[model samples]
Target: MMWPFDRCRINENDLFKHDWRSRSKVQVPQYIFLKWTLAFLVGLLTGLIATFINLVIENIAGYKFLAVFHFIENERYLIGLAYFTGANLILTAFAAVLCVCFAPTAAGPGIPEIKAYLNGIDIPNMFGATTLIVKIFGSIGAVAAGLDLGKEGPLVHIGSCIAALVGQGGPDNYRIKWRCLCYFNNDRDRRDIITCGASSGVCAAFRAPVGGVLFSLEEVATWWRSALLWRTFFSTAVVVVVLRAFIEICNSGKCGLFGTGGLIMFDVSDVIVTYHATDIIPVIIIGILGGFLRSLYNYFLHKVLRLYSLINQKGRMHKLLLSLTVSLFTSVCQYCLPFLAKCQPFDPSTTEACPANGWSGNFKQFNCAKGYYNDLATLLLTSNDDAVRNIFSSNTPKEFQPVSLLIFFALYCILGLFTFSIAVPSGLFLPIILIGSAYGRLLGVFMGSYTNIDHGLYAVLGAASLMAGSMRMTVSLCIIFLELTNNLLLLPITMLVLLITKTVGDSFNPSVYEIILHLKGLPFLDANPEPWMRNLTVGELAESRITSVTLCGVEKVSLIVDVLKNHSQWVPYCR
Candidate 1:
């Protein structure tokens, strides 16, 4: 939910300079040529190289080592525990060493680092071309090692570096001013250029331009006046264009509007426009719940950091051992649980039947049924046995009951938040939505008896609404969800839920990023704090005091003595 951007430091002295709104806009051709010539080449090279590294780490390294210690194949919990322990030990060693050597800036979410860098924090070693390699390979290693962190955070930094490196070759301030004399000339700050890369990365990841832009505006920068509004919009458009073109080249004519549609559609019949007033209550409830989830996630992360620090302070080796212990536990649980083990194999008789309880192969085809003993039930579902089929068909009504789903939703949220707080590098982006969707599915099964809404719609709507609530961006959330899924019909519902979640969430706590910055003693606060606040320096905020001294003297000796005495006291000068 953290939007991709933070705050910008505006120069107070330049406030009265030519108003940007009425200034001659940069011609599309020249400005774009500059960005494309530089930003594209840099971003492309960075992205492709990063992507390649991810492929190698994920495809090559993981398969080679993970297979030997994979006890989950035999459905043995103890063996799985050993595997998890061994894997965690190896991963922690790799992560700790690599993190110290390269990509040290990637310790936490790289968003704060990006914000700090934009505010002129000196990062002498902010690798120009090398960051691409580190971000790509490091992220791949982290994820493959099962550290549970997301790639988007590091991608933000990677993108910013690419943009900065590309823009580094651009004209300096004096040259930019001289060039401004030309009517066609336009001077874009490093912020816009960096944002172009950042947004493009977000768009590339989620394939949602509006969401990416909103993320930049909301979490990236705090201050925004009308001057920046239009410029950012134009810049976002350019970046989105770049992303779209690249995606098209990658997938070739499969994306709907942007990428894979999941929730909404653009073309809607007028008949589907019927929204009763009663929908408002449910929408509001959704928003509040979303905010609660966000708060819980943040709270858990805070606790994890605190606890991990305390444990590590005892000794560095102890911390690694603790992480290794967590890994063993997780692996043990994963192996014991039937559904977690693997999807049951498909039956020849029933096309919907899943595979065995434990399979090391692809899981994309399995039905992700929920519940504690869900694996056993799923296996039964796949079996051709008449007795198993009869038992499953009879229990279907109870299995899909609303009460059962509510419990699942609660657990899903808890697990999702926990997984993210573990401090391992994996994307939290989809996990949040996945949790929300699963919860929504459970709620849908319960609410279906009373409402006309389809369960799939509920699942998608819940994800959108919860995301909006967590992020606290209503319009942007709505537009993004609509764009991402190409589902226009759900817009009204998504908006309703977003409003509900944001209202409740905001009332309880500000954005998580603000809380983090406050805790870190960072100068800026809010998406955009006051301009003066940004200009206020640490020196200005310090308290000062003055002291006076007296001296006595006479003739030459007195004069020398007086000079020494005055110098000793550092007396004030009197002209």
Candidate 2:
């Protein structure tokens, strides 16, 4: 079969010059088909490999990070500190060297480079192989370091490299034997490769196949045309199936990769807030504040990056030193004030805490964690509306404390932002999400105490909203959480908050991906502009001295067929 890229269409008038049957009979060679098939198979295998890397990172590095260091206690604050410092230093140092040395295209989100590739731009030579190695090492290192970052970013590149290898067709890669060709001769299908990788990465990370394709199209390709959808859907589906199958095979067909059991099967019970109507006003107020916070984060991060650039002019080493220093300070703060570090518990006495007690069914307030998990737990346990009412009405703490949480968030954002700027091979998807979630939860506590709304729900809302705001990826962020927990009851509210937050953030700052690319001196980083001809208006083209086409009834088929076979014939009558 002729691939879409190789097929040349014919118009009605071409029938005058060529025979339809002869041209229509043209077929793709077996060898070329084999190679393309092999590419797909290789991509499938690489997808599984990429998934393996992700699983290992997620479980070992993401959750039990301190496990990397046998000396530290599992949940001790020092383990967090050591994990953040020692690991970040080494990772930062490696990233610094990699930036100057290999210069792979896997830095920051990997989305931008994929975007550029799709638009016919060239990526670095070592983009594929180097990225696969660097991202796994650096991200694992970052996770081991405890920087509040995630592995979703690296997976994008890893997925893309898998695609590239499948499509591998450089001159040096060819053999002299008779498999003679299907390779596109040119090595510029970079976008296609990267898009494949990115789509698969997002899919594997969230276990939401369609969402991944939407993300690659919306956030990476920025291509919403009809034709590209099928390929994107097909590729994402294929990769996810392979990855999931491998996961099942590894877990003995019992869904071991996503989870074992209890955590995934827990159900939420209805909550009775004393005055549900009264809470609407407060919830709305929380949403408005959440939007504002989203905007603020974008603003602060941009300013921090500017400041970091101003202070560290020496090179990657200076930048590394600066980030290390900031990380150390954050680490120290996190250790001294355990409440400040990533994913801290909400405080009820303060207006900022999430009102988790209202939903938890657990009328005993302040017992749950600070974020989403707590919110769900709260929804099931709270029984008395009066208890919920009393909890909301109780006088919050007299004083506001920003010294620790604020400092920790600031440092965390700074380190994450600069890490992207420094060209470290890493994914910004999770880091940005983590940053948004952390900031949202911290602010959520204040809103909870002041507004009497559930901080847990607010934090969950914040996590999704902030992610949507920062990355400018609302659909994927919302869908990601849905798939992660397989819960949808709160989807509507999540989408509403995400919409407001995204709009607010866009008004203030470029999406994270665009900003990173802009920092690297890239052009049109947000959208890939079409070539000049495609950009031309139909009116202008029609008005030009160009040939036209016209078509009649039965002759249409013959004309098209003739055009297909002719070398230099006109098809001006198809229209």
The number of the candidate with the highest TM-score is: 1
The 0-to-1 C-alpha lDDT of every candidate, in the order given, reads 0.49, 0.51
Model 2 lDDT, residue 214, Cα: 80
TM-score for all models, in order of appearance: 0.66, 0.64
Off by over 4 Å in 1: 1-36, 42-92, 116-132, 169-188, 223-281, 309-326, 339-427, 525-575
RMSD of each: 10.5, 11.3
Query: What does the lDDT come to for candidate 1?
Result: 0.49
lDDT of 2: 0.51
Q: In candidate 2, what are the lDDT values of residues 479-502, reduced to their tens digit?
A: 766665455666666677777777
